[model samples]
Target: MTLYETIFTRRSVRQYDQVQLEASVLAEIRQAIDNEKQLPGQNARFEIVNADRLKGVAAPHAILAYSAGTDAALANIGYTLQGVDLHLQNSGYGSLWMGMGKPIEQSADYRILLAFGKTSAPLRAGQGDFKRKSATEISNEDNAIARVARLAPSAVNFQPWKLDFSPGKVVVRPDGGGIRKLLTGNLQKIDLGIILKCVELALEREGKAVTALTPKGGGKTFAVEVAFE
Candidate 1:
């Protein structure tokens, strides 16, 4: 399956049978993880754990845990993790971003988990039918990329970023209010990067080309512009 198809078809799977990932598939995943760790601006690392190792942990059937040392690192980890997830889905495997606090001993200061396995059953009715907010709902201006960004996953599905579009520039800010408090700091920003990557992937699939500029400012509250050549 193509990466675009995987993006559209992938969904969170929580159950699995007694099955082991094929050696080739496991190798591909390991290679991808290695490449992601080498990517600049992120200190993310991943490990594949056997079912026995996950017995008492809050992890999924087979777990791949990604970790970093800081909030900034965590954000980068999220982006890289999603990219790997999309790639895995395209390769005919299913994956879900497992939530944190699943009971695990960790030396790293920051961490996230993803569970992988074949879908126990076919896609049920409305399995991939989740809806995203309209452009106007998420941003006032027309941001094709930000629209895709809105589809990025978050901890418990809590999307907590707001975009302000200016000519050749898109400003991003935290929308931490009531329930949004659940998503804060690096997790929120990292999730934003993941969504941005998805938007970029989707746009590329449609044959539209865009150049993403570095986020403006130094910290929190930045901008990413999608410039069409």
Candidate 2:
């Protein structure tokens, strides 16, 4: 399946089968991470933890633990990780981002985890199941991208975000009213990355394209300038 198809078809999987990952599958994942690290402006490092070691460390079944060299490094981390997430989904692996809290450690760097494995059974969660505000609710009637932005995920399913459309841009801002400050720190940034994945995929499926700008300054708000080529 295509990446966009996987976005619509994928659902969060919380359970997994006992089978171990295939050698080829493991290689592909490692290769993808390696390639992403070589991309320009990327400083994040990804390490594949052994499932047994993970269990020993009280980690999830299969994890890609990522850490950035600095705070400014997170934007590149966000973009690259989203690509990794979508690639895994398209390859038929069940994956979810774990962002509630980081495990206590001596390390001072920022960390995010991606868990992957085969689903033990059919996914119990519904795909595209969340209720989204109508186009009129979030933007002008002609704003088609708002429909896709509504599909983005937030911490604990809060969906705390709003979109504003102008002549050629779509602004994404978080609604702090619904977000719990401590429970999710910097997670919303990762969630925004996921939303960007959905919007890009959805727009491409419709034969549309847009330029995504790197988020500037820290706050709940960010913008993606979408213009026709």
Best candidate, TM-score-wise? 1
lDDT of each: 0.59, 0.56
lDDT of 2: 0.56
Q: How do all models score by TM-score?
A: 0.77, 0.76
Q: For every model in order, what is the number of clashing pairs? A: 1, 0
Pairs that collide in candidate 2 are none
User: Positional deviation of 222 in candidate 2, in angstroms?
Assistant: 5.1
Model 1 regions more than 4 Å off? 35-40, 55-71, 101-103, 123-128, 183-186, 206-228
C-alpha lDDT of residue 119 in model 2:
67
Best by lDDT: 1
> How many angstroms is residue 89 displaced in model 1 relative to the true structure, after the best TM-score fit?
2.0
**Candidate 1 lDDT, 60-128, residue by residue in tens:** 344444555444455566667887787766676667776553424555443656777766644324324
